[model samples]
Target: MKKLLAFLTLGLLLFLAACSSEGGSAKEPGNNGDTSDSAENAEKQEVTFWHSMGGAGQEALNKIVEEYNTSQDGIQVNAEYQGTYDESLTKFNAVAGSDSAPSVIQTFEIGTMSMINSGQITPIQEFVDADSYDMSGLEENITNYYSLDGKFYSMPFNSSTPVMYYNKDAFKAAGLDPETPPATYEEVEEASKKIVESNPEMKGFALQAYGWLWEQLLANQGALLLNNDNGRTDTPTEIGWTEEEGKSILEWVKRMVDDETFANYGTNGDNMMAGFLAGDVSMFLQSSASSRDVIDNAPFEVGIAYLPHPEDKERQGVVIGGASLWMIDGKSEEEQKAAWEFMKYLQTPEIQAEWHVGTGYFAINPGAYEEQVVKDAHAEKPQLQVTVDQLQDTKASYATQGALMDMLPEGRKIMETALEKIYNGGDVDEAYNTAVEQFNVAIEQANAARGE
Candidate 1:
């Protein structure tokens, strides 16, 4: 049955992850918990950064590093692209044993808990205290996902939240107010009916068939994604997606799909982008980090708004969706200090503003919005302002602070499989129950491996 398939799929993923981490060439001294010679890092003028960003994200990152390098006379910061987030993290584990390990690497949002468990990274608080760095300007809501016990494990760089993007031209033709977008799932459903009535050839709403978006849907409705305060206060032994909150989301999706107001675009993000660009869908939801790409590619005027939620519950806000920079443990003092300096320089309002404008990522530093460049951009496209406003309005809660799970990657895949099954005519309750069961298996595997 489809339910059993989902369980087997995640079980396979767990097996592969274990084998890779513990067997064969993947086993090295400094990676995945073998920090043997990490202390032998020599004093060198060069510091390296391994990142997974590609395309526009990579270009923006390269530009910032170039400016940082030329701005100073001593340390030379070099960046290397290591493919997607998963591939990059695997590569980090592979090289963590050698001096070749990057001084600092960019690990994606979900990897935060796993990176902390790896024992290969040094806490940023160590360097921050040594240098007396001021971190007051960074947004607390954005930093919460990367922090633990009032301290940051890594330096948050590219951060983003989910937002609803609609075609303004389609709204006008559909007789809906372009200025006032849907604020709740009930409103979205109503608006979808009107839009589909006006334009029968186009779908009313389409979101990526990705687990992260579904997780955001629950979080926005004040639902926790994991146990123990999103795994902040304690390590979660089981997943938290089998509750009424998840069922509510599944029911909404089922309604939309049944009404032909929503349809599957597959799991790839490009499917969402392609469908929207070709006019197959009227509105969509994706990461704020994709703002630049969407704004550039859409042929119509794209309007952005905060993600809609259930009408009955208040919004708890969304979680940060991008990566952060982590200092590798065992480097020489000089390299460690230089890496810290580069991280601080990158956090400046001026640099943060530039990165935000160039890549459509959050400035991380709230002060960056005050910069002239950001102000001008906001004046040009008011949609840019929505992301910032949404962050400011987020309620500080366990749900909004975000979840930390060592099996997060596997959990996401489980959610993705459930969505695929539901869209393909499977029972929503059965699909979700399967996801919960599979995720618990992964949690147990992670706990046992970590000696919990």
Candidate 2:
């Protein structure tokens, strides 16, 4: 009996020892951060990129990723579509709370400040300056919006400028030359009046009427949307768009709305494009990035022109639209290095040119224009050159300057509310003042949250 008892105790001891050993070797819940692994130390780096572009944009992005994946053996890229831009941002924020987030995220231009404030992104300046990467060919202008205080946190990939898209059929029907798009806001108003009076069946001028769109218009007139260095001063600030210039722009819009020259289309994000496609609207003011959709699906000849200015010769350069590629912070050094390499590869002239032509965005690499394919495309379609031509005379606007605030998206919502009021018979000045006040409150909240 003594011997049996000793044997049982020995067996229990051994079992406990085995269990302890197993516990010690198991990895703790691999807490996912901005980086899956250390980019420097990773042996095999797999870059996961979350983007909102689907269809043609997605296909083009995938082609670039595939080429990068095959061009080298050290790293592999995985691309995933996260729906629309807003949805992608929401998904990113949600994933950031867990351990399975992607390494690269594509975020819209306005979202940059919010993302920067979130501290989840790794600056690209480090990667671009790395000995392994060559950034000489990248244009300074394209990189302007992605930079903050001389440090680049993101790389400009699919950059676009807003332009005037007029339906040639509508123009001709209205007895206006399709080639002579409105050159100024006054011209636009006059043209809109004529077009509306001529074509009672369709709306004359269609604005996307989003807050961002409003900001763009304000910027065109040299107005500042936010007070603190236009959000670049790096401090808490309030919305200043209720000022004289901003109010004037809104009043102009109100006039158009009142005259029935403009159509709201009820915030169907896709409806503005649909309006153009269905011939329900005469012309559209949208980003050049939309060229692909119009070309691929429009029922008639689409005319592209530079965004009209408040003055004919004084058209302030329009701000860039579209998103940039941002690397999530906290990745393994190896992964970051690989991401850098892939970014450099993606920015090559050949790739940029092909992407710009395929996706209807301007190439971040100026040298991209020298490529044979780009030359051929520009020759074949002259309107595709409008973005480039306008950019030559471009100067960033006070309001259009890249925003740096956590509450900008909210501010945009406030402006949208103001727009809604204007379109729905509210006093334009009163609505704008209310929006400005509301945005200021949001700004204060954001600043407080950031402990600024």
lDDT of each: 0.85, 0.77
Report the lDDT tens digits of candidate 1 across residue range 70-102. Answer: 677667888999899999999999988688888
Could you estimate the TM-score for every candidate? 0.89, 0.85
Scored by lDDT, model 2 comes in at 0.77
lDDT of 2 by residue, 1-452 (tens): 99999999999999999999987766556543324535422555788888888878888888888777667668888888999888999888887735577888889887888787667888888776766455545765567666677678788888887888888888888889998998887788888888887888788777765777777777776667777667766575676554776676677778888888987764554898898899888777787888777866888988888777666335566666778888888788887777777777778889998898889888888889999999998888777888788765677544555566667788778877887777777898699778777888898898888777
Candidate 1 error regions (>4 Å): 1-44
For candidate 2, the 10 contiguous residues with the lowest summed lDDT are 32-41
Prediction 1 TM-score vs. true: 0.89
Candidate 2's TM-score: 0.85
Once fitted onto the true fold, the runs of candidate 2 whose alpha carbons sit more than 4 angstroms away are: 1-44, 97-99, 132-136, 311-313, 397-399
Predicted structure with the largest lDDT when compared to the true one: 1
